[model samples]
Target: MQTLDLAVLRTLIAVVESGSFAAAARRIGRSESAVSLQLKRLEEQIGEAVFVRNGKQMTLTGAGARLVGYARRLLDLNDEALAVSEKSIDGTVTLGVPHDVAETWLPAVICGFRRSHPSATLKVIEGRSAILQSRLADGQIDLAVVLTATRPANALWSANLPMVWIGRSDFHLKKNEPLQLAAFDPPCFFRAAAIASLEGADIGWSIGHASNTLPDLWSAVSLGLGVAVRTPAAVPPGLTVLDGRRGLPDLPPLHVSLCGPPVEFKKPAVDCLRVILEECLAVSIHAAA
Candidate 1:
């Protein structure tokens, strides 16, 4: 086996980014022939061609595309290694969180973390709670905030927060008009709960709109399209809570949990992030209460 050269990797990345050998050579401060030779040697070592020739253009072959992805990540890792050698606590923490939570809660949480540990970078991936949970289970992120019907596996903290029913302030209905809802598609706890509650109450209700994403659904609700079920902390601005004339049960509170990959949680950086997230969660829960 032979050693892989960082110079070759750098050249490959530059070529990919620049989209041509000449441009790559110019960007990396190397002659075009030198760049081409480095790529040929890299391909020989890897036993595959790294790029497809198209006149003056260059594109990665399937194997080449995959290798470029790995090469880019390796370069990023090398950069981080160098950065961490000089700076304290330098690394990336990928966090998975729900969309609504990110919109309402993440800025404050990130601001606090950055203030305390400026060298540690944060990357946030926002999606539905279920998707975030899957990513956490796969060790794709350092930590996550998720909602589950029951206790989440291997979690450090859990709290129940009330989900509220809200409608636009300008919305009007006949005396007997039942609540109509704008909801996300299936696998959404809020949507399921809203439907279950309305059906159980025998209200004359219907699905006014459905969105594959939360922001769009919230937009629809804010436009007086229909009522929406949301966590109290995330009630859209300018919306009013709706109530049944007869006493009705508050929507079941969602169980928010703090979780991470089991191994990563042992690191100090991960632990610091855990504490920060828990503190933020506590403040949010209290504020909503």
Candidate 2:
């Protein structure tokens, strides 16, 4: 029996994610026919069909579902296997990240970096998007991951962060009552968004608490200080997403972005880090959404 091709497995993963052979082709930089041929070849190699079409949706067959899990594992091993030979990468690379992501989404990036560049040093600076973006532009960091309400032109990669209203379970908003809020410190997108959304809806609001970090914010929120906008996926365990029946204006999906130079100084190493972080964030945000 022939060995499973890594390219085919990656393509298959993309197809499952993209929901169609054509979209997956676009994602993996292959022609639709090429993707289809690869899938056929994969099925031939495995001696079982992977995907079966059901009405408008192409659902994965039992065999396909099982292989999907294996594909992810193999892909990671492939990345590590390749990174092991990378020579003499010993520079200190500064990575600026939002505080929220530093807690929830950064461990994967850090683990991948440590595995791939054992000799390299990574300095992390945590702040809000405005501060991170400014630092990136000023060359204070090699790259910065930030959250934005809209996708910008230079975003290396962008993913959806689902925004939700979060508050205590029994919290209720009386008619035209000022929206009590526990806001993140200045330079926070969530705070600005919540205020803008409330004001646009002609809703009065007051800042009941201000927090500089996730723990403080979570604490303030859990204490029923006020309602806040947060990405439910990254929200702390105690807070619950407010019911949509509350007549609150819908918050738009936050665009999580990675920003780096047009040409990184450490091109090869930086490229490796970028791909790892991008894929990690993609899977994370996709799951959250």
lDDT of 2 at 40: 88
Best by lDDT: 2
Model 1 misplaced stretches (Cα beyond 4 Å): 1-88, 170-178, 246-249, 263-265
Question: lDDT tens digits, residues 1-289, model 1?
Answer: 6977655687788888888877775565444555677788789999998888878877789989988888888867765654553345557888888866776667656755665667788899988888888887787887888877777876788898878787776665555776667888778988888778767767667788888777788888887777888776655556766665423335777788887767544555677677778866775565564
Can you give the TM-score per candidate against the true fold?
0.65, 0.72
lDDT of each: 0.74, 0.79
TM-score winner: 2
TM-score of model number 2? 0.72
Stretches of candidate 2 off by over 4 Å are 1-80, 264-266
